[model samples]
Target: MLNLPKEKVIFAGYATFFMISLTKTTNNRLKDKLKTKSYTTRGG
Candidate 1:
């Protein structure tokens, strides 16, 4: 019984970490896209 609860907690923590990292990665991609588009429009 103790092990079961511990396992669930670990899984939840890993899932949370994964989601946070994924969001950060997506945000970076969006930022890069916007920068490139702006540069191209500016003829830089």
Candidate 2:
């Protein structure tokens, strides 16, 4: 009995996708920064 409108549901789906992508990218950037810092500390 899920009676939801089409456009609203689609919009919400897209919003969720964008949020997930943003989080993944943000995490990746943080990981890259940590790796860079570790390498620099070890190398120097």
lDDT for every model? 0.99, 0.94
Clashes of 1: 0
- Per-residue lDDT tens digits of candidate 2, residues 1-44? 35567778998999999999999999999999999999999999
Clashing pairs in model 1?
none
Candidate 2 clashing pairs?
none
Candidate 2 C-alpha error for residue 18, in Å:
0.1
RMSD of each: 1.1, 3.2
Q: Please give the lDDT score for candidate 1.
A: 0.99
Please, what are the lDDT tens digits per residue for candidate 1 over residues 1-44?
89999999999999999999999999999999999999999996
Worst 10 residues of 2 by lDDT: 1-10
Superposed by TM-score, candidate 1 places the C-alpha of residue 22 at a distance from the truth, in angstroms, of: 0.2
> For candidate 2, what is the TM-score?
0.87
